[model samples]
Target: MHLDKTPATRGLPRERPVLLAYLRWILLVTLVAVASACALSWALHHPSFESEIRVLVEPAEPRVGAAVAPDMETERQVAISGVVTAAAAQQVGVSATYLQEHASVTVPAASTVLVIQFDDTSAASAQRYAQAIADAYVDYRKGQAATLSAASMPTAATTPNYPVNGAAGLALGLIVGVGSALLRDRSDDRLRGPRDFVERTELPILATVPVRRRRWRRASLLPVLRDPSSTAGEAYRQVSGKVERAARQRRKLTTVTLFTSPSASDGVAHVAANTAIALAQSGHRVVLVECDVRVPRLAGLFDIPSGPGVARALVGRVPLNQALQASEVENLSLLPAGSPGPLGPGELFTFGAVGRLLSAIPADIDHVVVLTPPVLDAAETAVVAEHAHLLVLVAVIGATTRRDLEGAAAELSGGPSSLFGGVLLKAGRGGRAARRSQPLPAEWDDDMGPTAPEDDGVAEETPGTTAIDRRGRA
Candidate 1:
């Protein structure tokens, strides 16, 4: 089961659920922005009335063959001058600056027409201001007939214009939200769905353990031991069944399975503990080995003392039987990682201590489950993986990265260990339902095999209990 081909050829398809997760954050940000914009617009907004006045302008004497237009720019400037503005202000009982700020004058291109626009808080005030400006401009042009003349009295409009549009604001918010969601999806590197693991590694997933929400204050860590009928317990049982079937197919006198991950905190230790329990529940003499000397968790998990375990046995300070401790579970034994000697964890494994420790296990044990440190973080995992009969990779659903899994796979595939498959842990509800319901293998019976004879040889009466051939088929 060693794959020499690179995993780089495998590519993960983008999942809709991951995109929806990204969209949720994007929409949240968009809503906040839109609300703030709307609030500021309301707080700073001032409603005003607008009025327009149209005036017809013409030269006092019509020039039939004029080289250029009758200087409309000069007439436009004269309409908004201080003299006309002062007169408008006096008529309207307002300051000259106020009249100038509120009114504007424009002349239409290639035409003898001037338009005056004014804005005020009151509709009547806006109309009055526009009319006053037009009248003042007409009187000022009375003496300058050669330049321009007011052809008609100004006519003011009563309607007002509003500037805000709700539809436009909504459109802007949606555009921003979608843009942000795309950016977030591009930047996220963690695996978000089962497809990520399947496509990236091209490895068959053995089981998907659902995310266990901490419902109570003191929840037990071993779900299979505490509640075998729970979702988590069922998942562990499924994994254990697969491991047992694989081991049976190997047909080796001793079956050693190593569980490790790309990094720490991926819950490989927990999976190893529960899988051992599940195996022992089915009437197998299972031995759970804690080889992660640097940071051991099985000792604390089972509430057992940590001394005289793997570390002591490896260094020849303690015999194998002295290190083997009994757990509360029936037919299951525990070997916790003892205190790191003066050589430290790194130096202890270099002397071929791990292999010797594993080989020294009692011949009567059915399965030896070893929980090792993360492959990427610790060197001991590579050493242990070399001796184990099978390797099971553990990856957290949302926490593990594609690069990490690929790197771990490449490292193990290059080594001597045979990769069984992978287990995706902490998978949410979707993963649980996505898993195909598989019936337990018929060979996994309560009386799978007879006890080994006293001479450390497999009993001859139980040929059916012997390991199945390497194909894993009965």
Candidate 2:
């Protein structure tokens, strides 16, 4: 997965896996903060009030005749008074006011309304006491009234109201929830969408290859190739479309080279081959050229015999026609770097045959794709890049570093403008691309003739005379 650090023709945004993981963490923290704030507020703002109950009494004195004084009012020693103490208060039909002793009461001097409050275990008991205070004033007033020829009567008992504190709890919870969500979204850094690409680099993205999930193996080829509806197939097709678009723009037989930065992997080869197949499938004659002279890949990918390939072809030791073999896929062909050979001077750079081979391809063929070496080893890739009409760099999502991209960019940057298109590969999860519904293109009968059986794996060769693989893997 090691990729060239240079800014790709289409620099991709940061990985999404990192972003999603961050989002989850943010939400969890937010919820926790909200719950804690609510719990704390409820504990502090819990309501407390006093209430009481009491029997009310209305006492009025019967007024003696107004003239009782003239009639020599009999000196009667009839006196009545009531003492209400903590113990005798309730017995005398009065609610105990012990709780009120610890309570506070406030009232404006100019107002008759009073506010009596106390903390008590029982709301009913507090209400009873509140009632008693109201009753006592009523009784005393009634006696005075009667003596003055005007009497008042006691009123029915009423209980005080209780306060609620639920609203405060809700408010605290909301504040914590929203605040946390916002902070989380801002601090996150992993790239999530295409927008990140614009912000990070100057390269124009040629294609954004969706990440495919299906297990990639040699055996999975047909299933993937046949299932255009599948994510992997679709991605291949899209990549192919990109190739075709780039190819059409070029007026002559074009060499579309695929190279990844740093180490080599099958990713580039897969892209190169698939893209070639896709173009051929679309009815344009295509050739998948194995230009990696270091460690050729065409033999393995096409199941052809491996030997001196582009290197041999360059030296004129192997003829162009002898190096190429028809593919099982129609309108598609393979030019594998023929049987393995030793690296030598003038093998790639000094060859006039290289130019001749380019001239040798029939005009009927639409495109010639070269899978080049890693940019770090620019000798070979640069050679191929020089020859290619358009250069396409395939970079893995995370495996490529900024430094690597920069290096690759420096190597391939000055080439023909617009001839280069960067392909960002493996950017998403597997399932998102795997469940596509389109049927795989039907395998051609004559074109998809028997493919070469698998054999020794030397790896994809480099573009020039260098002895390294395209990925620098060797």
Candidate 3:
């Protein structure tokens, strides 16, 4: 009946379940990224073994006066120079360019020492090349005193540490996975909840009926008569009351309200049927019309014995009164969407029907609720909108999308129909007990038509109310 704040101020989604809808996707992405990165690192990386050999160095001749300190930095550079590398390559029977590419030199601080290091894929080759380079460097400095002191053979390569590499891969995977999830969340078109739907469409909320469970296909979800004490049932009652109030606010008498959705399976038909029942339960004379000729559900909804309905009446095969069947609910007449003739369902609704049908309905009827197909899916839905005084869009959370809502809003707003705001199919555990306690009609499957329970034609009504006849007359 009321609306939250405007869309301009809304950012984060309000519901916890809706916000976490795509959590599995994020976890999957992270897992796959981690596995792939680890696999690639293991496959593409090659280990490099390094070996080191140290040597002592001194001036070749004794100093005449004070002993000048040797320039170890300069000595370090000379050890790996072209001349020493060429000699080392000859000693190791390898090319000088190859030896130079794999060789490096360093010196200890404040000492006459040089350390020669070489790297290779083979550990033995690294050790041999390192020793050869030190021997050659000692030979190259003929005037200096140099002697090979010690050599350390490599046990393993330092380049490919599996633990470190795995940790890095994990960090990268987390970053990419979380970033992808965040970006997708911002651009996701699926409706999160009432606030998200309201934000995108900028339409007032008529009512929010709780959905205990999600269904792959449209199942039996009508709750007004199924369990009037339950949360879902009360919500439907709220929907009906708000709708009539909306019609009165527009100052319209005998208002014809159309219930629709942006896409199919949003439970628009179910909502419309329940709303009509709820209205009639509150003592309003109501006529429920199944205008969605393409996929008519109302004919089987109340187990109307497969008789003629609106489709046959529209094409003149039967009179509109014959198409109208009285439901079990008091004061409620149901006009089912009967099978179409040669004209086809699409052309039937889009071209013409509602104007003639309205003329046939009795003037005493206070509310006429027309259930129509989705706006985006069927062209006739917009055409049907042209005949109604109020339009109610049913939006199912986590199923109806933002783009579809915006599109539906554009289509309905452009028409002559008065916007009656939107109804949100809220998700919660409050209705779980109701759904379990109320038996779902086995007949209700993909068709979404649930039959009334078997009962004798008897009344347990108040003394003032009269019995409902087949023609919806007392």
Per lDDT, the best of the predicted structures is: 3
- Could you tell me how far off, in angstroms, the CA of residue 394 lies in candidate 3 after the best superposition? 2.2
**Model 1 shows how many backbone clashes?**
0
Top TM-score: which candidate number?
1
Q: What does candidate 2's lDDT look like per residue over 151-195, in tens digits?
A: 122232222211122344345445554565556546533223333
Per-residue lDDT tens digits for candidate 1, residues 25-79, read: 6677667666666666656656566777776665655467654445777777777
* lDDT values, one for every candidate: 0.69, 0.49, 0.71
Error of 2 at 49 (Å): 32
**Model 2: lDDT of residue 155:** 36
Off by over 4 Å in 2: 1-201, 211-214, 219-224, 253-263, 344-353, 427-429, 433-474
Q: How accurate is candidate 2 locally (lDDT)?
A: 0.49
**RMSD per prediction, one decimal?**
10.2, 12.7, 8.6
**Model 1 compared with the native: what TM-score?**
0.73
